[model samples]
Target: MAIELETETADGDDFVVYNHVAPPLSELDMQVIKSVPPGGNWADIPLSIAQKSKRIMQIRKSGGRTTYYGRLRNDLPSYTVSTYFYRPGNGSFVHPEQDRMISVREAARLQSFFDEHRFLGPASSQYKQVGNAVPPLLGRAVGVTIPSGFAVDLFCGAGGLSHGLR
Candidate 1:
């Protein structure tokens, strides 16, 4: 599996997608992603169909993790975006509509990262940056409670609180 960026005018959203790229994926990876439905996971794939995959077959034998090969649910909140989001086998990373992993920008959006906060690195590093981020939205939520005081930020995780408080 790999992370590939695709750009489109985000409909009814504040973000514009661009700087698209790909990490490259094998045919098997694409097939597995295509097999999942919105809100579906590895269990949705029949054993007969996924048999060609050693990992998938092993998952079947061991009983699957809910996060494994999961697709996003359009109507629901997203699951946590971990560093493993780049791979379909690792988390609920598949796009709700497209038969591919969610792009870096999309994952950033999930983390409430603004469009201007560009990630500068290889595709894997970009994915890592987005996945490990502490969302500005969450920080903003915390900031809301402080009312007014000497805000002392002790733990800095990408200046999320500072961004939100700004």
Candidate 2:
């Protein structure tokens, strides 16, 4: 639940090159993100404000998962990290208390990336890098579950699972 950077950064510890910082939100975006609370989702937004969104309107009328526009809960495991974690509309990427999406480093922490592992490139690419790869801890769990057994992983990217198995 807690994370630490491997080294000192220009922005200090909580915020490194790819940590703590979040994208700016539009006025409407701010309203929507603010409406949700810890463990709350799109359904938590007031009807007046929620109806403004074409997608939210559709989901409201028809039906959809509440995962959209969701915030994290301290007592629960984090929702799976996705490539669009920088966008709250994409998933439950919002911070429980802050009115912004989780930062790249936060996503990486959820994905169990090592503190020493640095991601370079634009923030977008950094997010993708964090989301696309399997968590090293998950890989280690899989490896431990079937000790001494041969397994072939198809289309494995980053090979964290394979590496952990070895």
Candidate 3:
């Protein structure tokens, strides 16, 4: 069977989509996904114990911040950032690893957002947007099933699946 799908980009660009059938995730991928916490990154764990870590360089110093280079909300300084241990239940303001919450860019990368994707607004706003976005990789996995039959996306937000479908 074949199916046609429509996707729209954040900028409102439209495209048609199709896909081929593929097997479900293997045991290893499932295990990895299961092991990883939601919105968590390697930095969530202690540096001495973490398997991976990422550093985010801010565009401007926090004291004299410019809109173009500050952290997503301009409230925090640029420094080492990771989502290795972030969890919604742990509270909104606590850092998943260090004493500060993860930055917007850090959250975005964990959610599979490409570095090239420019986010709009302040640091906190960006973090909220990135945190709320669906992981693009997961959306791509779902898109792989489009060619086999009709696909429905429940709780679609910002159309990540639609982007993947294309």
Candidate 4:
């Protein structure tokens, strides 16, 4: 979710600026957020909690890939956004310092959205939009490298590449 930014109007009038609202996280999710450190993951969680968690048990039983509870590093670009980013076990979608999953607005910024680009939808839908979006920075770099005037996007969910070209 987006945070509010205070700003004044150009005509020297008082105005509340950059209105934003983030969905609140649940208590359990908050606990997990506080326990995990930047760039850390489920590995960083206390052994007691980790062992007791159902996700861990399922991972051990299945032997499938389990990088769940991955955290992000503030100093570097984050890992690719995944479709199921709300689930910590899905990808490195946690906030670097905040004890929570990165907000929808934060995810959007990572994908090269300016603060003005407001996402309109329920929290889950907003997340899906951000997760599916191409990183605008990557799109710009690739678009410039490509030697074509006309561009065609087969499944442009959020138009990151199209925005870059524009």
Model 3, which residues run further than 4 Å from truth?
A: 1-97, 148-166
Judged by whole-model lDDT over C-alpha atoms, candidate 4 comes out at: 0.68
- Looking at model 4, the pairs that clash are 1-104, 68-89, 69-88, 69-89
Candidate 2 regions exceeding 4 Å error are 1-18, 144-166
TM-score (C-alpha) between model 2 and the true structure: 0.76
Q: Model 3 TM-score?
A: 0.34
Put down candidate 1 lDDT per residue, 1-166, tens digits, no spaces.
Answer: 3444433355744454543443455788888888889999999887666998999999988988987999998899999999878788998988898777777778888899876678887887888788788899998998888769656765568657566664
Q: What is the TM-score of each candidate against the true structure?
A: 0.75, 0.76, 0.34, 0.68
- What's the best-to-worst order under lDDT? 2, 1, 4, 3
Residue pairs with backbone overlap in model 2: none
Please give, for residues 28-118, the per-residue lDDT of candidate 2 as tens digits. 8889999998999888889999877898888777777879889998789998888888887888989877777777877888999866678
Which candidate gets the maximum TM-score versus the true structure?
2
Q: What is the lDDT of residue 152 in candidate 1?
A: 72
Model 4 Cα shift for residue 145 (angstroms): 2.6
Clashing pairs in 1: none
For model 3, give the 10-residue run with minimal summed lDDT. 53-62
Number of the candidate with higher TM-score, 1 or 3: 1
lDDT of 3 by residue, 1-166 (tens): 1222235677998753322111133443233233334343322333332223122121111222221111122344433233322332123323323323344445555567765576776544555566566778879987896787665665379657576664
Better of 1 and 4 by TM-score: 1
Q: Write one digit per residue (lDDT tens) for candidate 4, span 7-47.
A: 55667766532214444666665666678777776666675
